[model samples]
Target: MSSNAALLFQGGIGVIGLVAMLLFGIPVLLVGPGLWPSILLGALGASLTYAALLLLTRVPGLFPENLERQMQGLYDFASSYSPVVLILLSLLAGVGEELLFRGAIQGWLMANTDPVTAVLAASVLFGLVHYVSFTYFLVATGLGLILGAAYVLSESLVLVMVWHALYDMIALYCLLRFPRWFGVRIVDPVTNRPHE
Candidate 1:
């Protein structure tokens, strides 16, 4: 499929999943109103995840070059669109993925298992759905762990949604505006070693 078509398909699927979760899963989970504290914690969690990525990027050979190339290719494709489209796409990804992984799956798991197990299961599923690569899967799983922890702490999906959306926007902007920073072959400033 064309990139645009793929994005549309993803967004449409996400919307459908979110709606289904809201209509069916919410009542089944007995989810209550959002708590301010949980929301704040969720925001913190998202910020921390972004910060962690920033730190990781600074380390030489931390992430595979192939991943950078793949990400750059994606960024190049996304760069063809307007800012509004990018924002909307990011929002779609954030909302749709969170709804399915955190809201529906995690909620269901919490009902039958412990919170830790639920979070891990949901996180693993989240990683698997990406189907990018083992490295990417691991990265996604780590991010999922952060998201899950935030949910457990704040019990607020909205907070995580905002966090995820903001994170995506920041990442998209960086990838578009500063492509050089993501190069695979570079000297690790701290270790003085080649990244590749």
Candidate 2:
């Protein structure tokens, strides 16, 4: 899909999150201070995720051929867009998804349940929605856990939003810029040639 269309679609997610927040009567101002720390922490989360992917891909028989194929297909689509557009999409997804999953669903769960339950429940839901393969489900769930932890730590949706968005943006950047880092051998869309 065109990046513009992707933007519109992602924007709708933010709207849905907002509607859910309002309908559920969840407070919207969970955003707090600590902006600098949030950015650094978000970047760290992205780095850790990248390292995990590298390590996981190296484990023999762990990442299946089919899952690798699916990921390649996704990378092809993601690499078709401009970096700026992709980053924007990441931001939208971060805000929209974190808002609903963390702010609304997790927030509601925390109100009714314990923090651990809320994080696990919301992370599982996040994983389910992003499920492409079992491995991917696990990875997405792991990412959700990271975001949820950030939220719990700072009580700031803004922090998790930064973390989630940075994680996505970094992942996309890595997938396109260094496919072999994840054990894939595909054409680098930017250079129109395979990675060396």
How many clashing residue pairs are found in candidate 2? Answer: 0
lDDT of each: 0.73, 0.81
TM-score winner among the candidates?
2
Where does candidate 1 stray beyond 4 Å? 1-7, 19-44, 64-66, 184-196
User: Number of clashes in every candidate structure?
Assistant: 1, 0
Q: What is the TM-score of each candidate against the true structure?
A: 0.78, 0.86
TM-score of decoy 1: 0.78
Candidate with top lDDT is 2
lDDT of 1 by residue, 11-36 (tens): 87667666767776542221234556
Q: Residue 49 of model 1: what lDDT? A: 79
lDDT tens digits, residue span 54-146, model 2: 677778887544567766877878878988999899999988998889999898888889999999999999999998888888878988897
